[model samples]
Target: MGFKSKRKIKTNFVSAANKKLRLAWDRKHRQLTVSDWRKWVFSGKTRVNMGGSDSESFYWSDVPGTNRPHQVRPQVQGISDGVMVWGCISGDRPGYSTAIIDGAIDSNKYVEILKTSLMQTLE
Candidate 1:
């Protein structure tokens, strides 16, 4: 409800198949918690607090300087060609490093990374 973001795009949740999947996941989570699938021996709610984070980096190549005249040619800098790297961290565990294809990432590509690298870190 109130968790909706200001920049959110409106969509029909009831008509979305993904909504059913999310609901199923929530149901499983609730079931496991109820059945004590993971026993809480610690006094606090969180014993070893589990967290995950990921980041992306770009590496740019340096361009060589030219001896052309200053007034005749505009100032030129390095080319925009770069490689992107994605990595994640979870407590002491680290996920595998991934290279984004051509500085572009879509839903399918992101899911593949999650399934491989991110999943390993989580496990």
Candidate 2:
């Protein structure tokens, strides 16, 4: 047996429709200049696991190949076991972040985060 211990690759399931939409979006913006891209601020939210990720998993593969179905772990987004935070970055510098101590962010909370973190980042 050629089985070897390896860390499973984490991935999210993307619907066919979403995949097509992503391709279309990519095509639409493929010609964007660096300056055009620089004008945009990238922002996102993520969960910072306190101890470690509960989703960490391992797999065995005899065949040494990349992205085999068995080696790919499908991750489903759910309530985080630790803190959630929002942050952003421009072309030049990283932006401020807001840690969610309470829980999930509602619209009001999102607005407040933007008002404070994002606003401060822009300044």
Candidate 3:
């Protein structure tokens, strides 16, 4: 099966496709806005705020004390998936966002996309 055809896509236009997917992820999600897709990226996964101190912002800690920081939190990832509005900006209002977050969170497709995106970006 073709890599892309395996997916059920709508409005099959490259220029608008990415935007559509992003908006889809924004409509249903409550925390991470469509603008925060960067966090779902593998590069961002390791760098996002896990949970350390009670600072206003996300911080990374590698200390050997009682308050050692954790830089990796799957809950954040779950939140990312939950708040994902997969296909937005296609509704009424013409630039409207979607509320669909039906992507396989831990499926091969998820891994493949992230791996592919990471390779292209990091490599």
- Quote each prediction's TM-score: 0.35, 0.69, 0.20
The per-residue C-alpha lDDT of model 2 at residue 113 equals 94
Best by TM-score: 2
Query: TM-score for model 3?
Result: 0.20
Cα lDDT of model 2 by residue, 1-123, tens digit: 999766668798999999999999999999999989887889999888765676755776777867888677655466445888999999878999889978888899999999999999888
Model 1 stretches astray by more than 4 angstroms: 1-80
Candidate 1 TM-score to native: 0.35
Q: Report the alpha-carbon TM-score of model 2 versus the true structure.
A: 0.69
lDDT of 3 by residue, 55-99 (tens): 333444556444434444333444443333222122122222223
Cα deviation at 88, candidate 1, in Å, is 0.5
Off by over 4 Å in 3: 1-63, 68-80, 86-94, 104-123
lDDT value for model 1: 0.51
Best by lDDT: 2
Q: Give me the displacement of residue 86 in model 3, in angstroms.
A: 4.7
lDDT of each candidate versus the true structure:
0.51, 0.84, 0.41
> What value of lDDT does candidate 2 attain over all alpha carbons?
0.84
